[model samples]
Target: MGLGAGPPAVKRRSFTRASVAVAVAVGLVLAGACGGGGGDGDGDGDGDGSLSVGVLLPGGGASRFGQFDGPLIEKQLKRLCPDCPAPTIAATSDPAVQRQQLESMITRRVDVLVLAAVDPQLLRPSVEAAHRAGIPVVAYDRLAQGPISGYVTFDGTTVGRLQGEALLKAMGTKARGGQIVMMNGATTDPNAGWFKRGALSVLQGKVKIGKSYDTVGWRPENAFVNMTRAIAALGAGDIDGVLAANDSLAGAVVAALNAAEVRPLPPITGQDADLAGVRRIVRGDQYMTVYKPFEPAATAAAKMAVALGRGRTVGSIATGTVDSATTKNIPAVLLPSVPVTVGNIKGTLVKDGMYTIDQICTPALRSACAKAGLTR
Candidate 1:
């Protein structure tokens, strides 16, 4: 996401023995702070230890936010504060619905909120309302504007760079003088702009951008329409590669190209490392994808939320600081992302415990999986 200044420099934070010890200590402190018995059980305005958390996500069901982030964050929260009330989780792609969810959390006077905003700008007022209610809002994945206490997400610029570099590498001889179509994410999410900027830094001089379109709502259908338009404007042969912002968009681009009957598919880049994206890579429809490990990100966000709930600063948890449009130098955890291609799928995705060999290698993809050296 775009910050007030330039993107913060991303330094890999190793989970050393000392870091683990610190994390344990922090968790213990939070547990002790929240284990007391007093005030209303809802953990509302009574100023008791009954920690209450609210989660807002962009989408649900098979999407990363649904399949991974939500469950992982909840799991981490329970581990940290077993006595705390079960968190209230809600998911929606509509900015209006997300705002209503935030308001509901505010009305309940939740201790803290972990939000993955659908539209950062649109949710600014709701975030402000949460702040007014003395509920600390931790911006998760997408940076929401307003007075947020902390933030946690993967390095968007790095994600874009990985996609751009992989696309160029996949293009091979065509890389010297190639034409590419840029299928970016939604305009409402600042991350879309952030990814686009980073990709342009690497792709501006190397390739000719024949067409570029920002897919509204980050929807695959929108991307498909845009890709079809690009094909009509710039013939399939002239389009050498596609720099799609995420896996969903990349799938749409691939489908559109296939529908147009492009003989040999062009190299396409994606992020999020969704299972479908990995399958596409094995089937030779997509070139690569960026995998932002969900465990670390969820853990970081959960810790930040719990600490804030206990009236503690996130100085111990945050690796760096980021400035949003309305908030300055907010405590932030900028995690790293890994690029996944057919060559490194086993080493990155499966080896990291994100997916099993059998999960990625379904019956239909057995031959392709074998060719890619992905076996039991």
Candidate 2:
């Protein structure tokens, strides 16, 4: 779950013009079904001496799922296998829908599958089916519960530890005995439990947990509703801080606090350097967010998928191994996550090109941007 000390910092690399062009072309081919399915029947092969990759993301609305992961993976795949048919991508929040999509890809007899399971356990049967069909599955972001050949994701427990440590720092003196609310991700996502465990490891003796809730579907509305309940039960003034699992939930928690008219909002922790989350940090609404460089993770997954499809070993690409509920010693590339506060906006997001000053510092955010030293 936790990768102990953070991984050595990776030097960010820029894509060449030719690779960018190919990525754009691949993007066009997979346009329509950004949150659904694409490609034709029985993808056994692209019929052009090329392999077909099936990518199933766990729905949109999280920002990263569609905006970052999907496109990044597409680009990396194209760059790696120029002749391969553009990957078939599908996105859904429902496990049943994901299962059906997986089955459809299996029926198409795709060469390989890159899946970010909606519910790891519920999708086991589909993964098994893919395995039986001789299609290697690369579990993306979340570890799926079947015979996955490889995994690509940030260290889950480390993500939690970063959030917890940031929360403690933001809370300052109050952290010694402050009562905080934990707004964790969906129970169906194994990463959610791992995150909670890591956070508890750092927070248990340091602070009192006033309330904790596992959001359903990792939906912001669900988080909003849960935050409202926590406020009602604990009283707004009694809560010291909020430990939100990700940026979406952080937004929901912030909204609930605003709705309750809780003055001088408490420090809130989040993961995923989402634009809104970064904006929140600039405005002093959110204390910090974890930034997991997605390009490298996407590149690793793309390489693994393509290699597996070609019957090549992935030992060189995998940095480590992880155990799923039903599988053990699965090869994995566990990337490190960086803690991004207002102080390091330039070093993290801006430096990595995840966001430019112009993008982050809109007309409305110019003042905050300037104050945060984001002037360009």
Candidate 3:
């Protein structure tokens, strides 16, 4: 949700397939030579022909992208198709970088390309190029419009409602008369709008929205600047809560509040139970984060990509389908999310094997972890 290719700006110039594709292929061959296949899916553990898969992530800046999405996806791809060419993966912080990565994957003629687009519309042509090349593109996380063979992401509305409900609960006695700020994600992302709509469904009349801002790039720094402005306009004491779209933005919000010296900080909500966010909850700085298990979601995407690569239907890969604005009734894997508060940090993230106690409790947070009942 943090990924934004900036504003629509100049719609992608007419794509030059031959120009970008050739360069991309050369780059891939060089990178592949260095990325030893090892036990990666290149082995076709299932005794099938070797498969080649490519994955392009939006950014590595969002800690979750590197820490959770990357390894989980690589591990699952190998489990689903041990003989597939070791999966090719890369991260680009900008849309232009993602476009170059897309073209390279296409040039390599990968069996399937899995993308968590930085900007779906601009990436549409690249996805279409893959389609024309007889390659299927599995839209992972953010839906990239095209003849997408499959889609995998947590239910957007459900994730939003969970965040909303948690925010209200955290507000407790303040819920009745409190005014809060809404720090949402980039408007370019359809998921961001879905999150806002779902949250408004519950937050509409119950709480007074003092100020709302659609974050520029889902960047913490952007959220920080915006939060600082909100504090200046609304005064620190009057704001009772914050609705940060994700853990990254939530962290920014908390930092801004801390700078403003907001004592007994107001309740804030976030998604993507990031370790820092969980640690903050233990120390009682932030309120909660939504834990959307990465394993099942990653597994579903890998299975779909492998199935598509082998010229098979996504029947086994999808639990259902979703209707997108540009595309109707797309094959999809809808994952569930759980709201995580200080009281249940262990029961959710720790128990799910998402993060170990050691990974979570550093020397600085050791005491806080103990206070949260996480001592082992």
Candidate 4:
């Protein structure tokens, strides 16, 4: 899905006027001039309720950041603090560029930052810099290193478990010593390792992994290249299943398989119930996808950001605690994820108002929709 438009509260402006590719700040409304400065706490360490939230996502455009997380965060922030200034939103997939954006935000001195780091370890120094500036940082979606104040995300372990379980079920007879290819996400993302570990816990003893590759930058093009190489190395026929990290990767895998003219495609697992991924499941191209409801995750991040900005403890809002490489016992809200397939598409995505029947079932997919039991 594509992003509709920037939130009405957003004010467009150049972030440091830097021409870094992929680094875009939706609007950088300075907090100092608007009476919503960061670390605006009283002598007793309690804030006067003035908030200026800054949001930074890993990517933009058709990515989840633009399509769901950004808008939902803005809405929730507005609901919680009506008088607060609009957040300074930014997105970039380049690690160096993301670090530059975070440094710029610190210079601007936003009250609290909501961050989904492109590369958690690469962004650690910048996160530390923000902490030293007395600006509380709330890590959203992906966890970053250094003194992060709060975190909100779906459990990566559970997401992988669901994907692994679904892939095995789809493989059926092949699940007994089946040889599969592993298309894992970028190593820069901590969640990638988390997901891979969770999936390996369930898949290791049951299946034989023929070829495995880590797609650099989590880029679809890289996935395609890797998949093509795997097809050439394994001769396509030996590959019984595929464990794709997400929907985008799954699409690339499918395309590569089709390019190799592999008839009767093997089962493929995916995550992030993107519209296209859901339709792929209906068409019997992909096996399943893990749906991490964006609303609750965004809302939780907004709540944590607001509380941190107001100089309040997040202990009450956090359901649990997580320890990062640098920080110990960090407050967190790890939500659950649901596995989506053709059978559960209606009850999960459609029933939750994520998509309409018309959206998933296009005119070209009429017969496929009928076969999948999807009807308006």
Best by lDDT: 1
Query: Candidate 3 residues 1-376, lDDT tens each?
Result: 3223221111111212121223233223212211123322232336557788899987775477788888778887776666565789989767788998999989988888889987787788898899999999888888777678888876677677878888889899878768999999887576777777768878888999999999876889999999999999999899999999998899999999999999989999998898888888888888988887776667677767766776667653455676655566677766667788988888777876778999888899888888899966
TM for every model, in the order presented, reads 0.89, 0.87, 0.86, 0.87
lDDT of 2 by residue, 154-240 (tens): 777778888999999999999999999999988788788878887888999999999999899899999999999999999989999
Residue pairs with colliding backbones in model 4 are 38-111
* Local accuracy by lDDT, each model: 0.83, 0.81, 0.76, 0.79
For model 1, how does the per-residue alpha-carbon lDDT over 257-286 read when each residue is reduced to its tens digit? 999999699999999889999999999999
Candidate 3 lDDT (Cα, 0 to 1): 0.76
The 10-residue segment with the lowest total lDDT in model 2:
33-42
Q: Which TM-score value belongs to model 2? A: 0.87
Q: Which regions of candidate 2 are displaced past 4 Å?
A: 1-49
lDDT of 4 by residue, 1-376 (tens): 0010110011112212121111111111111011133442112222346578899999888887888899989987776677778898999889899899999999999989999988887888899999999999998978788899988876777778888898999999999899999999888787887788778888999999998888899999999999999999988788999999999999999999999999899999999888889889999899999987777777678777876876767775565777776777888776677788899888778877778999999998999998877887
Cα deviation at 363, candidate 2, in Å, is 1.9
The Cα RMSD in angstroms, rounded to one decimal, for candidate 4 relative to the true structure is 10.6
> What is the lDDT for 107 in model 1?
92
Positional deviation of residue 349's Cα in model 2 after best superposition, in angstroms: 0.1
Stronger candidate by lDDT (3 vs 4): 4
